[model samples]
Target: MSFVTLSNSRVETTPPVENNSDSGVLSPEPDASMQEYYQLQMDLLILTVILTGVIFVTVCFFYPLKIALNYLLGAVGSVVYLRMLAKDVEKLGRQQQRLSKARLAIFIGLIVVATQWNSLSILPIFLGFLTYKAALILYVLKSVLMPES
Candidate 1:
């Protein structure tokens, strides 16, 4: 463990990772906590896909097929965004890197394309992109409302 002092403040950062004597590089094996983190990431993705399917089917029943298809496109984008976010998070401490804005760029690009394309409806697509957020909220609520035995 290491700490740096700036002025009067003490800042804590990722501890020095053990280096492999032969390779002279950081160990590639992840710790146990990373396994739990990976499971959480996988769970969120699964929940988002399930939610997207249900919402897409509901939209198809009430709206035109075109709108439903637009929403599906955005849902796919949202999945990509979530995957990128998870990768960034997984790299956080281990790699000692800052979070990237590529995920936000993806969302912005999706919106821009949706707006420019005459066939795509912006509202449904935007709503579809928020599917991941809904899944996050659900996960939080579930964790708070239900605890492991």
Candidate 2:
């Protein structure tokens, strides 16, 4: 081929390569922070399902209590139940502070209960629920009870 013809027919076949990362797009690394966050969220969801299952089992285990208590702790109102649960935890704290040795056993028993209750996950839904109620009581104590006091 003549130099002029060869030069005219020469082609540049290299296509333009666009960088996705440079354009503010995400890469596909599983250990990326976003992926980690998503994984943590999924792990939390699984933990929640597991915790709920354990609570269901615990409740099932306690099912006979309802029948047994038909006469004893009779149909207490919701308000009464809340007060009782709150006072019980408070009394436990007070008794723990006063007689640590005696309360230690109770504390250890609670620890065992918590452990057996949530062996699969260390999540504490039962105590957490009680804490939420305590917090609500505290909020009320601050907002309403304090002003009155």
Candidate 3:
């Protein structure tokens, strides 16, 4: 492979020429930025899971088992919700997606509110939701500070 300079600040890789005797098919190269983005997403997911576990264990020490379980469930629910949203956004670009952030937040909030009215505590659920938001904030910050090359 060789590097091609498009501008003073940017350089791109040019695929090496393959022998004609070999298979004519060209293999695709993996994108570095895409790999980095996926790695960051996985890291955020693992961090969220660890935070949820820590919160659950800490709450368990002070609260009853049932309440502790409720907190864990809420955290898991938030994680699932965020994952689903990410999948949806991936499948359909943000401009094409019908759901807005406000709508998504309201929908999730309603679900949590329903749970609170029925049985579980609102504070724990809200805290769990905030954890996901924190992860999102971190992701945005990272992206802003270190843009893809």
Candidate 4:
């Protein structure tokens, strides 16, 4: 509590305001709210891997081996991109104020190689790179449809 004196000899007491700004020193361990965020990140990563496997198997069954291999490469790159994004988000405010462009470099490199390589098909690889977005859409739909779960 803090006390303040008025000009007319009046006195008042007030509670101290809590500081919630990120400029302050952060705790060594994340709090409960941050735990939920970390859990969501893990869940997204898991869901992406599951979708990648299902799609890869389906592609292998329907398409040629070369196209399936190209898609697998792109899907792996997508997973790497997702993890890098999560790491960058986790470091936000503590280490950096903005997201890094380094993550996009992986996708650009993949596209460049796909365009240059004769065996790789651009369409399959591009679709594979969107695997993470598909997983995220599924996650959001689940959350919206089944909030209690």
Name the best candidate (by lDDT).
4
Which regions in candidate 1 have their CA more than 4 angstroms from the true location? 1-29
Better of 2 and 4 by lDDT: 4
> Candidate 3's error at 58, in angstroms?
0.5
Clashes of each: 0, 0, 0, 0
By lDDT, the better pick of 1 and 2 is: 1
Q: Tens digit of lDDT per residue, candidate 1, span 1-149?
A: 32345655766443234445567777655456765777798899999999999999999999999999989988999999999998788768656568988789888998999889898889988999999999999999888988681
| Candidate 3 RMSD to the correct structure | 12.0
Report the error of model 2 at residue 141, Å: 29
1-149 in candidate 3: lDDT tens per residue?
23465877887545333233356554454356444544665677876787788878998999898778767766777677767665454435423656546436644764657565777776666676666776777667777998772
- Indicate the residue-level lDDT of 113 in model 4: 96
Ranking by lDDT: 4, 1, 3, 2
Instruction: Output the number of the TM-score-best candidate.
Output: 4
Global fold similarity of model 2 (TM-score): 0.27
lDDT of each: 0.83, 0.37, 0.64, 0.85
- Give a tens-digit lDDT track for model 4, residues 54-102: 9999999999988898889999999999999987887787568999999
CA shift of 93, model 3, Å: 4.7
Q: On lDDT, who's better, 3 or 4? A: 4
Residue pairs of candidate 2 with colliding backbone atoms = none
**RMSD of candidates 1 onward, in order:** 12.2, 26.5, 12.0, 14.8
